[model samples]
Target: MPYQKLTAKELLALGNAAPEVNDSSWCVTWDPSEEGSAAERLVLDTLPPVLDFHTSGSTGPSRCWRRTRETAWLEAGMLAEFVGAGTPHAPGAVVAFAPPLHVYGALATFLVPARLGVPVWYRKEYVGALPETGQRRALVVATPWIFSLLLRHLDWVRSFEHLTVLYSSAMLPSDAGTLLEQAGPGRVTLVELLGSTETGGIAVRRWEGGESPVWTLFPDVTRVDGDAPGDEGAVPLVIRSPRLGHRPGEPQPAEWHTGDLVEPLDDRTFRLVGRIGRLVKVNGRRVNLDETEHRLRARLHCADLALVPVSDPMIGEHVDFYVVPALDTRADELDLSPVLALLGARPRRVHVVPAISRSALGKLRPQQTP
Candidate 1:
């Protein structure tokens, strides 16, 4: 059956029932009302033993990628091995609260359980509720936004004593991790994933307990550059893995240049700095937006901050800092003196917005350069 032919309720049902289906069963869900006839025909005509997912356009335009059954199985096996090795725990039932469209959420929450033959339950709505009894060794996969929502509803979050793993991804702010660890009593293993749609899911890290951010690359993936690619201080990450899927007009490179900057700690571990495009030249000096934003965030009491570029006559572009201040805080009252002092340069402008606009997955919305 074509995916476009199904309704939203049907799609949700399919996802909910996917965990119960046997390995031989190929399950898929689509909203026919929104997709129209072409999408329906494609789903009906294609017998995809593999699963394909649309990338979250968190940073830029979204793209679709396919995950073959074999590759998916491999990914599951690798994750199980890694998780078990790092934290002595056996595989168990998984509860996914994130949308299936996101690769990290889908793979970690849904496909992993399916490949492992573990019973899984999915909640399409982010109500911050935990599953009741009868679900054993449950792994909860969600984003920081959902986590924050759950925190607000403490009664719902406290229901899960069986939670062995708490996996968060997309946009996991440092403070959020700290709060979740405190709330969970540090019993639940909090894992943050790092990877994209093109590379599938690559690595996982423990974001709480003051643990250093180190990502263990998937067994199938290998770092192409001796270190990662970028400036001497920073390295650009390149991936050579079988899990990556090809788009229609994508160049067949031996490895995919991720265009993400990183700091390589060792052969197996690295810390992601930011995207290469986030680097901007200011006064003939290169400034990494990620670093500047980090500094600004650390100094200022703001919910979120972004350093974007604005057109300049003398310089090609000048940096403008946008911030979403904490509740009851005014932009005028903000003591940006420390931030400006640290940067050694003032922003062309600082705009205080109501909320930091983000995509569905909570990633910063992509901005177009004027």
Candidate 2:
């Protein structure tokens, strides 16, 4: 049946959904959400109700994400309230620059719009002008990178009755948010999200004249100083959210040690500091690149291996491991299950090269800031 023929409740009733649905055979491509999209197709599958998704594995390997239908409704409602579209009867629309393939994109755009029973746009339509929302506000779902490109065209800012751009991935330069909110004072609302595929929607901050340093967390999410030995002011973020997403081999309602360190102001809010130690936050989990490299070195018996954290617009940071094997591993039938497990620590991409060749003077060519 076409997704438009089904209701939200009926769709969720379809249990055991697939992990990822990218087949063009599905319906709804860049069409309005009220008309439904491929999301409906995924639910129609006769599989057991296992809702699975994945992070955009741009830098590293993509990780499997497990979510439930109940959590989907909960998060969509949370996001709708965040952007001032709480009332399902209210007039509002969602415009998405990102696709449902990632967690952030799916929740903010697909699920939220479906919950609101509102018209929506996604995929290719993002390149076009804002949807005509009439008296209703339009919520835009995008990333830090897409914001830069969209800013180049402010022709549509004042076009909507009201516009709210929901951003995730990473915080941008403060001036970026300022520029957006200032486009139309109360007429425009810019909300930046501090969450991941693992933690779902943990916190949100609305940018006014400039982006604020503090973030307001969701009701179910709690932030605390990490228990690990660390400074009082700077420590890993100990997050306990009921709606937290699946982690391999971990149960729900468990505390997630967000690799991020933050100075606590209260239980629901905090000032975000950077990641802890050599660990960089990727999809809400901290990956210890240094330690991962050490393990690879020990197991592979190769001295020319290093892991570098690469920044991504979608998944924050991913690790790319550069390895100079004594012999080509692929050709030698090397068992790489151990490294595969280590790569699971974060999103990863593996590079097996001939050598870690350095300049004649031992000068590094270019280093990426983690």
Candidate 3:
């Protein structure tokens, strides 16, 4: 069979024919003009043994990657293992609010469950209707922004008592773990995934409580140590995994050099320091953008803020902060000048915008003014 594309309408018709079609798939698209037509193509096309997708370019341009059948199977098995899928009285079902086109949201929502023969209940229409279901043993895959919106509706929160797992990713805030734990009364298990489109899903953590988040390598993955942490102040992570993406017959690097900075706690667990590209030199001293952003968020009266690089003649490039003030809050109370001083540099500029522009998944849209 050769690969072919079908429109969403044709896909929907196929879906209507047998809503329980195990091998059928749909591609999520936000564009209204091509909605139904696009989905139909994906469904009718010859299914690839390996599915390929890209990540949202909130931080940068999206990168493309391929997922082999083995990779998908391994991911499904790991998810089942983590969530206790086969346990009696806790049969698992998947509900996803993230679009199926992107790696983080859609892959797990559709591929993992479909490959595992688990029933997936997808609502392409009203994503907010997720918690409104009556399913007892349910696993929800959503982004931080969707989770935050769901949290605002207490009625919806109460409806999730039977939920066993709540998974989130793509631009998750550090504090989100703690927030989820408090909101769910520990009945629901919150897992934060760390990975990109290029890397697939690499690590998982509880994301809340005082427990240190650690990376649990997939079954086929191995790590290589670069430099000791706190020495050069950046520890690079190297990966050798069978699950990595590559074209057939092409020689792939045995170890993938990830620009991610990590701190290893023992052999199995590690803490993410930041991305190598995210660090900037300020007056010859290195500044961690993650740390600076954390500090600025603490000082701001706004709901969120992001630090972005702006061209500077003196330093070649300098950081600027953008803030999204909370609704009904006065801007005068949110002074970021002191925060910049604390970060060891006077920011080139500060902009107060109506709201921070974020993707549907809560990733801060880099390069956007606000």
What lDDT would candidate 2 get against the real structure? 0.59
lDDT of each: 0.59, 0.59, 0.58
TM-score of each: 0.72, 0.61, 0.74
Cα miss at 41, model 3 (Å)? 21
* Cα lDDT tens digits for candidate 1, 253-326: 46777777778777788877767777766777677776676566657887777777667887676777777888
Q: Which scores better on TM-score, 1 or 3?
A: 3
- Cα error, residue 48 of model 2, in Å, equals 6.4
Provide C-alpha RMSD values for all models, in order. Answer: 8.1, 12.9, 8.0
Misplaced by over 4 Å in model 1 are 1-47, 83-88, 133-136, 153-171, 184-186, 226-229, 249-253, 280-288, 291-304, 309-313, 316-318, 325-342, 368-370
Worst 10 residues of 1 by lDDT: 21-30
Give a tens-digit lDDT track for model 2, residues 1-370.
1123234443334321322221111222223443233444433332234457665443235577677766776787778777775443243666666555567766765577765566555433324444444545677777544555556656666565667777876435333654566566666667778877777888888865553658778888877656774444566787888777785565664778876767777777777765454566666655655456545655774436566667777666777666665653552565556666877653466666666533211111234222
Looking at model 3, residue 140 earns an lDDT score of 64
